[model samples]
Target: IMEYKRGSTLRRGQWTAFVFLLMIVHQCVGDIRYSITEEIKRGSVVGRFSQDLGIDVKTLSTRRPRIEFEGNTRYCDINQKTGDLIVNERMDREELCGQRPSCALLFDFFLENPLELHRVTLEIQDVNDNFPTFPNEVIKLEISESAIKGERFSIDEALDTDTGVNSVQGYTLSANEHFTLSVHTSADTGKYAEIVLEHELDREKQDELSLILTAYDGGKPQKSGTVVIQVRVLDANDNVPVFTQSIYKVSVPENATLGTAVVTVSASDADEGANGELTYEFSHISIKTKNTFSLDPKSGEIKIKTMIDFEDTSSFELRVKAKDGAGQAASCKVIVDVADINDNAPVILIKSLKSPLPENSPAGTEVALIYVQDRDSESNSKVRCSIEQNTYFKLSPSIKKHISLITAVELDRETQSEYNITLIATDEGYPPLSSFQTITLIVSDVNDNQPVFDEQSYSAYVTENNKPGSSLCYVTARDRDWRQNGTVVYSLLASDVDGDPLKNLFLLDSKTGVINLAGPIDYEEQPIYELRVLAKDGAGLVSYTKVLIDITDVNDNAPVILIKTLTNPIPENVAPRALWPWR
Candidate 1:
């Protein structure tokens, strides 16, 4: 075991230096490989990244080794504390690789500082976590009493997700005198099981035969699955119904109405009376095909029973069986090729939605996740999702069939607090079908705007010697924000007019923004009063304005006449003496 120092031990300055060096030179050093079993517990050590790359623990830590892989799922990570590759998430081999014989996770192991990149491949080994499965629990087989020995009839095969020895190796049949098991292996189809008749089936002695068929995989404590085989023995009726053709092919539009006949299959029997009268039904057809088409027993006409979607299934292979009165039957294949139709409209499904988005959210912030689907074939199923042009929100393409709704610009609750985001999805079909879905998003308010007065400054006149507590004038302010954030309150900011506090002379109503005279005013003393008022919102945002009040003068005093030193009497005496001197 090799011990390596953790990446956390590296100094912050070293990491910064490494990042700076990485920008100068980046190179691929080569590749490394490892083998591990799937479904290991998270945090299980996989391999030493530093040891495998021939780098010292200190160097690895300084470089900050990181793993980069495809897709969103992170299966492994380099432990910073241990310099070891650890399982980040439990992986299922079957789901990761499906039926592929070899499963490997390929990722790039990058180191900063010196800037070296290495390709790391981890081969995941199977652990037989899943058991073999049969398509159904019961399989019904019809056999005629006149059938000869050694005749083989195909049976359903068991499926195992695990490959190689861990897969379904062989099948076993219950001991029976009438039937035996035959296994066949082919490169194209793999292995399949069949029932072989060892002896002729007798309808009188045994009308029904129940047998067990078990399939097992070659593993330690092997896993197995079983299906009950029910063989129904039929009475002797030699003549079998023969179809007009062994294979019939037809094309029907996906938009064809229900009960529209596609084709009529005719079959005839040479036997007379009860043996010649035949009935028709679907045989060995998939559930989807059977549900889409129905067969008329008497007319042998195949008609659409349910709506067919060309996108889900482009074509269907149906086996039609014609059985005579005595249980003799013949089957023919009907291939129905569904024609394309631009009938399905695109559909939008919301995966995640975040409402009450903050007004201060930056551009490109994800608001919602959406998925679009169209149930039509080929070009008709190709869909494009979009929102209104020049909107605050736009649809961004994400993973397949997924779209992200992100803000194109910052939001402001004062401008538009609530948004009805309409998303439209359209297919690429001729005369394309489109559909729309609307998402309502509300913008949450923030303390972004300060209270603003109706006018920058206000002035009101008050008479001199006015009574106390008189309503001088009202100050109105408005805030654009909503709820408590926009609630405005008024106050007279502390200020001095000739060393007198404005609050002592004037009063402000906090809720209504009303200014009133707190005390008596005299124009002879203080002719004009300059007031500064402040408006504040509940969120603590404040604004200020000026208010000037000029007091109007009234006739409050009487005028007094003053006598100058003997001027009035001297004027009258001079006028009389001037007259006497002239005489």
Candidate 2:
């Protein structure tokens, strides 16, 4: 008698309950593990379950060795007479084991008669179904512009699930002029590759390049995956600079100020690094042109160096050059046109004069002094002068551009004390320039006027800390004489302050009539200072005024205590009556 337990439900054709019957005297057989290609038909042979398990064919045929999948599906069954385990259902390895290299199907088996317990494992072998693939759709690489030939860059390998002849076998890169593909076998038997430089990289010509890399397997009709290879080239010094234009044109005013911009030129370079930087300068220079124009090295700007004169030269030709850090250069021509502007004016400068003539002087006496000049170019600045028509005065040329207004007839000073004559100047130009100035003639008067000071005495006080050349006081004088005869000048007379010259201690502004401190003052040296100042008319008539300067004290000196005397040898001998030194 034997007791049995159900192994679970094992279906045959439809569905059947699996029961395990144990014969008290029966032995358990070793489990069988067999491999077979997937996608097999229902009648495919798995293995000889009877012989491999030590069971006889007669016993296996009668008892019937059964294999049921865990999900109640019968995948293999023994022949009822031959004891051969055969496939009972379609087996797809991809669905059964996916991409796993080691995959097996475990099922329960139950036999009758004496009853027995055993297990079987069916391993599904994989076939080529999936293609090789890359983890990324594109591979990015950066190459230096200075890269030399034969330089290699390692790239990631492609991945494939299938093993043996079905896995990645090789790698190939698309054809290019600068690079080639080098393939190597990785330690894991995977195909690895590197990009080798066939030629040096030049970013100036081409900064970026694109290519393709294909990973392929040895399957029939070969399956492969492609990844885009993108390469970016970095910069290096390789090219020279080039100007945008061969020539440039500019116009500027003839009287343009120094540093006036004439034109700006721009250039470009194809190479990077130091080769791309550009600088500008005058390529062709002439003495006359160089004196009048200059260029900025960094900005490529041409500027006026000296004042230009349209009448002297209306047009100029310049050649400019541009250079790069690599010392390569290019040049262009610059045509500069100087436009005329109204800048020059006729000038009248006094040369000689004899005004304030005697009342009863005869005619033909030179009375006015003058000279004329124009600052335009030689052709435009040829100036001439003439005195306006008048009854008592006439214009007469004396020397080069020099003229005098002379008396036309005898004159009487009492009847008319003065005469105003106009001297006119003219230049030669398109619109000719002219200017006029008035000259005054006065009748003579005797030396009957003298200058008198507005104040007989001036007093001022300055602090000890006052800076040198500080204004202390103002004392002006007046004269009744007319014109130059009435002009009065003030001066400081020789004087002594603490035995020092007064001029050393004070100074006066001759025309403004201002007295200023000439040196630092000290209240301790001299508290008060007084001196006589003189006023003189143009005719040598003089008068005098007194100036007084009081110096105030400031806390600029530190206090000091002095010791008159102290006994040296009598100290240690007798000290009964002690005495302190007087200070």
Candidate 3:
């Protein structure tokens, strides 16, 4: 045997020989060549050293050594030439110590050394495990009547075990017209929803409402769940009351006693309960009386609380108010007329007056009469008259009961034309009412006057050729009576005052006092004459007077023929002697 240094020397020689053998083995395994087909299936592993050394690589031939990996770990790469596996770095030695490494560990080593290992093939399997849930299972919301359509209300939440689109995908509402929902995020940490009210709510019409909310997730198909929502409404006041009539009128008896009911008024309110209730009261009055009238608190019945006398009061005016329970009120006026009752007596203004005894007395004079008035029935109407001790005036008992007369004093125009006196009138009563009146008497002037002519005697002149109906001297008279009574008439009582009765010149105008010729006057037969005249009044009183008439001659009378004709001797031949004598 070669002398072997069994201690240090033998150790060195053994190291050298081991190194030499190790080099050879390294050279064979390290330089090993192998190729994975381009069409190699995932998770397929083969031993590269066994194929290169042409030896039964039993240890490495089973498949590629697998490394167990956990969450977020994977096989990063694999060596195609040597069939070396690469995996993530976090794999522990216990995972590698297993007789058959887990594929997860192989993925980890491949991922860890991805530069040395070029490729990795992993096949992760599916599992059915997680149930979908909501981030917040329930939601709450509020809305207003003023809210517009499609306004957003609030947001909701959901959760899911799966990720990506496999988590909560969308949301839905049962009452879509009233509300709506939409997904806010991509299932982040679970799922969430944004809810909105699709339509406005009117609290005045509806008080409360209900809604249903649902959330769905993306799975193989789809999955969904539901939530309930409750909503409440509030109230507001916005109404007014109306009346039936604008005004009311009533009539009541004047003698109606106190507390008598007159009439009732009313109004209406459309609201409910207290808001619609109405009441009545008096607002004003035309006549004020101390507690004389009142109204029913709720019914508005006008009543008389005190005595009403038509003798003193005729009508009453009242203003009434109708109020709702809401404190808003309206006012109206009512006229209450008090009917009349004839309970008063007539009174006299004048009691007595003096009597008048004149025929032509002026009007408005109290003469022989009494002023009487009745306060009772006509059967009780009685009046009497009497005159005090006076010789000139007397009262007649058997004649008119209230009349007096002028008896003893004879009315004479020469003595006195008027008389003013007094008389007394008395009625037949328990306390006979007596009154006195003054009477005025006037005596009228009778036709006892005689007409007096202007002169006792007068004269007039006339021409021989005076024509008939020619004016002569005028004769007039006077009387005491005025106008028609005092007027004097002219007439031929016996003969004309100028004594020309045969001369036909005795005509006169009674009213004008003018004398005129009744016919032609002949101066040869009655050159001068004496006449008589008469004057009278309508009362037939007459007076007489005389007048003298004198007639004068004029040349106008044709020359009473000393010679009937005269002739001119020389001019006879020229003009045939101017004229023939009258035959």
lDDT of each: 0.77, 0.71, 0.50
Instruction: Candidate 2: list runs displaced more than 4 Å.
Output: 1-26, 50-61, 70-83, 88-100, 148-151, 154-156, 186-189, 236-583
As for model 2, its CA RMSD to the true structure in angstroms is: 50.4
Give lDDT for model 3. 0.50
Q: What tens digits encode model 1's per-residue C-alpha lDDT throughout 1-583?
A: 2233322121111000000111112244556677898899999998998677677887778876778654458899988766899999989988787666888886656665454445667889998876777766787666678878887766666778787788888999999999889998855335668888889987888999899999998888899989898888875556678999998999999889999999999999997887789988776444456688889999999999999867656778877778777655677878899998888787776655668899999998778756666667677777777786547887665432246788989999988989998888878789988899999999999999889899988999989988989998988889998889899988887887778777788899999988888887888778888888889899899999999999999888789887544433334545543633211
Ranking by lDDT: 1, 2, 3
> Among these predicted structures, which one has the highest TM-score?
1
List candidate 1 stretches off by more than 4 Å: 1-251, 257-307, 311-315, 319-337, 359-365, 388-393, 406-415, 497-500, 552-583
Model 3 ranges off by over 4 Å:
1-403, 407-409, 412-446, 467-469, 482-487, 494-503, 552-583
| Candidate 3 Cα deviation (angstroms), residue 134 | 95
Better of 2 and 3 by TM-score: 2
lDDT of 2 by residue, 1-583 (tens): 1112233222212111111232122234445567887777898788776666667888777774555444546778767677777888877765564344566776655564443445566777766677877756876665668867886765556766665677788998888899898998844335777788998988889989999999998877688989998887864445556788887888897878888888898899897766677888664334467678888899888889898887556778776767676445666778898876545667776544567787667797767545565656554666666668778887665432245567888776546779888877777656777888988888785445688888889899989868888989989899876667678998888888658898888998887789998988899888898878888888899899988888889888899988677656455766777874543
Q: How would you encode candidate 3's per-residue C-alpha lDDT over 1-583 as one tens digit per residue?
A: 0111111110111000000111111000111122222223445453332343342444433433333222234433344444444232332322322111212211111111111111122322222123454433443333446556665544434444344455556777775456676656531123455556676778777756777767677767676666666555433223445657666777787668777888777777776776567777654222243156888877778788887765345556666666555444556667777764433222222212332234333432223322233332222234444556666555432111112243554444535666665665454444555556555655566666688877888888888777778888988788875456577887665543345444356676777867788877778666776766678787788898887778887766565648665564444355754654444
Error of 3 at 290 (Å): 22
lDDT of 1 at 31: 65
Give the TM-scores of the predictions, in the order they appear.
0.54, 0.32, 0.26
Q: Which is the winner by TM-score between candidate 1 and candidate 3? A: 1
After best superposition, candidate 2 residue 512: deviation in angstroms? 99
Score candidate 1 by lDDT.
Answer: 0.77
Error of 3 at 494 (Å): 5.3
Screening candidate 1 with a backbone cut-off below 3 angstroms (N, C-alpha, C), the clashing residue pairs are: 18-113
